[model samples]
Target: TGTICTRTALLDSRATGMFMDLAFARENGLDVQLLTHPIFYNVDGTLNEMGSVCKEVEVILWIDDHSKQVVFSMIRLGKTKLIIGHTWLHHHNLEINWTTGKLTLTQCLSDC
Candidate 1:
């Protein structure tokens, strides 16, 4: 949709899929796509109080010198705006240095 914006994102190993805050997506004027199937729970099987997740957006995520188009499901996130979850980490073969707070992508799929 050519919408470009930057925001703090959480890299959560516990999360199963990428996510974007609903309000943030609206504020950035990102084009929202309706999900073919709505989501009703978190990956952990906990109930989501915000109801079903029916919207999503595709955006180019830039981290330092790397960039990739990612789809983030729209949901109500309390304080966090964006989340790069385990699916992305595993697909990219990401390595994280907990001591130094550094992230490295060791591999890329054929798409890259």
Candidate 2:
């Protein structure tokens, strides 16, 4: 099942607004649809905001701003095995002790 979630915070009116005025809108018959889906338009398509609507997400597919409170909860419960799907600024702030090798590693999700 494929899904889409747009994070409204990242919207840029300048760059996107100019793109919307281009001729390809009517030529390709896609302007109206793309107008509403800006996050996928500018950057590499791989980084779209596809998690905003999920309620009970498994393996968070961690991104730029994981809340510190959620991470503290994970630490309080002693989750020893954490798979970081992607690294960003927030990933380094997770506060788990790794120098002592308290955590264990497993294969990446594609292999699992």
TM-score of each: 0.83, 0.16
lDDT of 1 by residue, 20-84 (tens): 99999988898989988998887678888877899999888887667898899999897999988
Instruction: Please give, for residues 1-112, the per-residue lDDT of candidate 2 as tens digits.
Output: 1222222122122322111212322233321322222333224445423322111122222234332221100111122222232232223323333585332222123321
What clash count does candidate 2 reach?
0
Model 2 misplaced regions, further than 4 Å: 1-43, 47-53, 57-68, 71-82, 85-99, 103-112
In order, what lDDT does every prediction score? 0.85, 0.25
Clashing pairs in 1: none
The TM-score measured for candidate 2 stands at 0.16
Off by over 4 Å in 1: 43-46
Q: Which candidate number has the best lDDT?
A: 1
